[model samples]
Target: MQETYRRSADSAKGRQRRAELLESVTRDLAEHGLVDFSLRRAARAAGTTHKVLLYYFADGDDLLAQALLRLRGQRVGNALQAVAALPSGTLGDRIRAIWPMLEADATGLRVIDQAIGLAMYDPARYAHLAREAAEQYLAPLTGLLPPEWSSARREEVANLLLATFRGFLMDWRTTSDTTRIESALEALARAMDREAADGP
Candidate 1:
């Protein structure tokens, strides 16, 4: 019994340590961006040794993927909370509420773009992560839509909104032209509102 208890305690401690490492890496990636990320770099960011990171993660890619996913989760969680507090209205209203939150996190967006670029560059290793990232982002956005709409309809709108948002984010990253992007965003929102009003 004592041996089992000791093992359980060790397991709990290990889990907690792993979580701390992950959190540290996620914050580092969010601030520094995910360019040429290596296990040694992650270790330095986490204030731990690479061997320690390997004990908790399979490899550098695995560590990087988890950090990116955590960053994405933080962004999505904040957006959901902010948007939920707002009164339900048109799709345009939701879009307007979400864009500012996303815009403010330019670092987060850039890191995510970098991860997507990894997938494009090395499909054998990173494509699954890109797909996972898409689903993780899409589900919450879809849930925010009106419940009366069919699953098909919600998913369709969610895909379009996600794609549009990604495009605008990429553009913003490239140009830093807030005025142009904001204007385009407003136009997109207005168009979505019109479509929502028309209904299925």
Candidate 2:
């Protein structure tokens, strides 16, 4: 009985420690970009040794995957909360509603963009992370669509909206041209609103 209790306590402690470490790494990545991340760097950010990080995470990639996913979740969670606070509006309103939140989080967007760039740079290492991030963002947007639409249509629109938003985000980040980005977003919102209304 004592041995079992001891093991259970150890497992609980391990989980808590891992969560703390993950939070530290997430904050670090937010402050410092993920362009040249390494296990040692994460360990340094967490104020622990690389060996300790390995004990909790499989490797640098696994740690990065979790951190990126956490960042994405925070972004989605914030957007959902913002949307919930507003009155139900057109599809265009929803698109417009979410943009300011995304636009405000320069750090979060930078991390996401960096993750995508990393995945593209080395597909073998980071491709799964990028795919998972896409799915995470896609599901919530699909849920926001009208129920009358077919599943296929909702998914298709979700993909196009995400792609468009990502492109505009990159452009905005690179150019810092709010006027051009806002114009593009307005065009997108109009297009989406039309598609949603003219549906099967």
Candidate 1: which stretches are off by over 4 Å? 1-10, 106-109
For candidate 2, write residues 1-200 as lDDT tens digits. Answer: 65564465359787889899999999999888886788989999999999878777878889988998888888888788878878778888888888887777766557877787778898998799779988999998998788999999989989998888888877877899999999988998898889877976
TM-scores, all candidates, are: 0.88, 0.90
Residue 189 of model 2, lDDT score? 88
lDDT of 2 at 40: 89
Q: TM-score: which candidate is best? A: 2
Error of 2 at 153 (Å): 0.6
Backbone clash pairs for candidate 1 read none
Instruction: Give per-residue CA lDDT, model 1, range 84-156, as digits (tens).
Output: 8786678788888888877777556568877777788999988977897888999988987777788898899
RMSD of 2: 3.2
Alpha-carbon deviation at 25 in model 1, angstroms: 1.2
Once model 2 is optimally superposed onto the true structure by TM-score, how far is the C-alpha of residue 28 displaced, in angstroms?
0.5
In candidate 2, which residue ranges exceed 4 Å CA deviation?
A: 1-10, 106-109
